[model samples]
Target: MQVNNDRLTLAVAKAPQIYLAGVIDADAPQRFESMMRSGKIANGSDIYLNASGADLHAGIALGRLFRQGSMVTHLGTQRRQRGAPAKPALCTDACVYAYLGGLYRWAPTGADRIGFPAQMAVDPKASADPDDTSAYLKEMDIDQSALAPLLTAAHADPAWLPADQLIAARIANNGRLPLTATYQVQNGEPYLTLAEVKRGGQHRMSLECRRDGVLFTAYNAVGAEHAKQIVAHGARSFVEVNHAESYPPQQDYATVQDDAVVIARTYPGAQLGSLISATTLGAWVRDRNSMLRYGFEFELGGLDHILRKYYQACWEYAPWQVAKKS
Candidate 1:
């Protein structure tokens, strides 16, 4: 266990788990890079962020390093006594920006804290540039709203973000991006696809509206192996909506297509209404012995509006128009 108690201290008492502490000044980045060059810390290491504040530019630089290394950041400090119980740690000012760099970020828990301070007040010689920080946050897929508290904070203190807000805006995402639904056209036919990327892999599903009904297809990259196993032996597949069984299980319903495992089915057009009104959707594969072989769920964010557009493009019909006609 090595410890450095300088302006910024970086230690790797536990392999692949680097512990960081102290204040971050302009030289923080260079010191961090030196720690990196020591080969003690590996890529994708867990970075325990125990620092309080940082120089604006210096924090951004450290953030870029965190992203490049695909690190995970948590708010906590190292224990002087080995195996000691967890203690509270605060990451404030530009340190908040550094925390956002983690590929997989854990929200501040219990007494652990993260906040944004008035940059100039925190460091009189700080080269604080809101534009640069804004761009960096955008690149991290953080909502612009996360920046508002920083720019508008009281000069005497730091603005702390609640854990819920951090998770909602994805500032403390557990290695996942927000799911999105998009309207796309192929061969003059419009369809809707909902997709998301996470540490596990990508999950996508498409809905095609037809005169008879709607065709639903789930493409699961993570389930590719399970799909192949099904083709070789056999298994039952089903779709789930809001944690309830939405489709009947059938043998050999999964098929491998290129890199993903796909399951396609058709349902009554009114089913589209149920889906549009639902909050979550998922697909599953079950073994003959009744075990859950594999599955994944998707949050139906912004899908209702896109599905409405798909209905109009498919059959020149919108639910509101039909409601008005009646």
Candidate 2:
């Protein structure tokens, strides 16, 4: 299911990116979904769009992209003919709705006069379910007042909002997610502050420590103590984080204490069997593998139990069998 008409087209490539141009249509969402499941466009890819808006139901497609956790960026290239004025592309109309789908958005720095149009108000029926729009606004951390003027259905050409307004509404992001964020932990564990936490990773896992609370990470620093608690008994259902690549730049492994589905990940993450020696586990966790093929997946546990044991057997330079947790 592909559409390559002059009005709208979707070009996907191995950079794992999508390029959208022209007007969006109702059926675009279905086609995009097919592309995602078929692995033509992997989930979490970034989107670069050049659209002045959409014909109809484009918001639905944009919302689906947003929920897929794909980042969105407005694309443009301005070249003035000698003595001519500059005309930058505006993500107006339903295009604004789609652009808002980016989890971490970006636009040319200092670029101005970009936003939705008065025509958005042309269809009162489009506002039929303010709840849906309201929900999206909340997720994007955008203000309701911001959308009122931008999405108004008046017949005039709308004045685009400036960067300050967009920044205040958090529509223009520079990659990092606000640590002032909040989320509910389903397992009744206390949520940890995300302050100073890095914001980008595909296979990040969410784990709960007996004393350390919840840690959602895709890197090596979930804390040495957190790793220890993971391999300890009773950690049956923790969430697992992966880098999505078999040989990601950074990695960690571990098994949950039990099996109510601990270490939940979108893909079957790597594991480090308990049968392996703690020394070998330590090398992997410490990233001492001499021939590690970048992007290849291995069976290391969610917390790298071997590293935890290695830390146990050698923490603080204590003697073997006399070290902490040994």
| Count of backbone collisions in candidate 2 | 32
Provide TM-scores for the models. Answer: 0.72, 0.45
The model with the greatest TM-score is: 1
- Candidate 1 lDDT score at position 285: 74
By lDDT, who's the top model here?
Answer: 1
The CA lDDT at 27 in model 2 is: 67
lDDT tens digits by residue: candidate 2, 1-326 = 22222222334322344666566777667777777777776555666555654543566466556557555454443333757754555566666777777766665444534665554333233344643555555655656665565545333466476665566556676554443322333454323222222233221222222222112332223344544543343322222124322222322344433221123222111122121222211111222333322111223333344345433322222232221232
lDDT of 1 by residue, 196-315 (tens): 877657888998766566778888885556558754443667888888888633343777886677878887665676765577888877766556467678877656677667666755
TM-score for predicted model 2 compared with the true structure: 0.45
- Angstrom error of the Cα, residue 141, model 1: value is 2.8
lDDT of 2: 0.44
Predictions in order: lDDT: 0.70, 0.44
Model 1, C-alpha of 13: deviation from truth (Å): 16
